[model samples]
Target: MPQLLMIEDDARLAQMVGEYLEQSGFVLTHATDGKAGLALLEAPTAAGLPDLVLLDLMLPDMDGLEVCRRLRALPSDAARLPVVMLTAKGDPMDRIIGLEMGADDYLPKPFEPRELLARIRAVLRRRGEAAPSARIMRFGSLEIDRDARTVTVAGEAREITSYQFDLLAALAERAGRVLTRDQIMEAVRGRELEAFDRSIDVHMGRIRAAIEADPKNPKRILTVRGVGYVFARQQD
Candidate 1:
């Protein structure tokens, strides 16, 4: 499953959101403060670090922004981990600060649970675990021209939406890796949006229908059971 660590001081909100997400097929690990949250990440398992982080700006030990900055400063590959700032402070300044500090997305307090889910999905989509675009990306019969925003299927050029292009580019870039929905959204939207209002799966479904010869039994893009999605490099 896609493991997520939530660092929030409000126990009630954490429990409510945890239960809600648990029902949605996500594994929820809790950290009551920023310190513990940072600890858990510092010691990740072979399964890899938590796929995403739902962080609150206020913590008992340290400010959430400081925690985010410190994490980003880490030298390991873990620096790429995406964090979503969830806080009651709806100030635009807070949102901007969070993003500027390396947060992938920011969700304000008194927000809808559905919106949270959307943001999570968007974050995963954007973080698609692919290599840098400087690396050539190929998946089965599809070849992506990252710099050109063009796709060649079976060696022929085909038109696709900008969003679709981004989605496919992300998956192809990752190729063999499993990318969570939150990662996908983060990669696709980059650092611009405050909320991911759209569902990543729906976009993936649309992309599949267009590219997969058999959408019902997709080959290029495959769902990685409870984790998220993976774009197989080979169709067979």
Candidate 2:
């Protein structure tokens, strides 16, 4: 069973979610605040860290975004840990902000348990498929080493979240092909794109910032207007 750490302050909702997830064959550890969640994450226990984190954006102690940023700043494996933010805010910007802060995914409040389960499964599945391979891809000064799960530009390591790395890898693997948002989502997460979903675009911007010398004039990943995006095969 996959272990999950849920950082949510609502006692009753946490109980309900914990029960549902446990019944669905997941082992859940609940933290009522961001501090507690970070503490648990930093502790090196014999059991190791949980497979994923379900972080609540509104926390009693600190903003969930701060927690996420701190988590990514950690000098340990916790930095790259997969996070899915849970928020009650209805604004799409909240979701986009969370994604920009390195969250793998997010679920708005009032979501059905089934949808939550599906999201969890999709995130976990993506992580599972991130195993190292022997293939190495290069374009100009950019290098993607599948065996090490690392990306470098001009011989310098580029800082990117693990999910963003996967997204870039997916696009690079199909270089020169214009892949629709739906196709990119399916390739990365094994799920269809949701209506009005701009998560892919957000991730793409982040990836470009990391790899492109000038993100404003990206040469590797090119946009295809209404179609989607393509990784350029030729480098100038």
Worst 10 residues of 2 by lDDT: 188-197
In candidate 2, how many Å is residue 50 off? 0.6
For candidate 1, what's the RMSD?
11.7
lDDT of each: 0.79, 0.84
Task: Give a tens-digit lDDT track for model 2, residues 73-139.
Answer: 9876678889999999988998888999999999989889889989999998887688544399887
Q: Runs in model 1 with CA error above 4 Å?
A: 45-47, 129-236
Q: 1-236 in candidate 1: lDDT tens per residue? A: 56788999898999999999988878788899988888777765333467788999989899899989988987654577889998877789988999999999988888898999989988888877453356446666777887787887788887777887888887776554578778777777763432553467777888888778899998778887677788765543
Shift in Å, residue 19, candidate 1 = 1.3
Model 2 lDDT, full chain set: 0.84
Cα lDDT, model 1, residue 195? 57
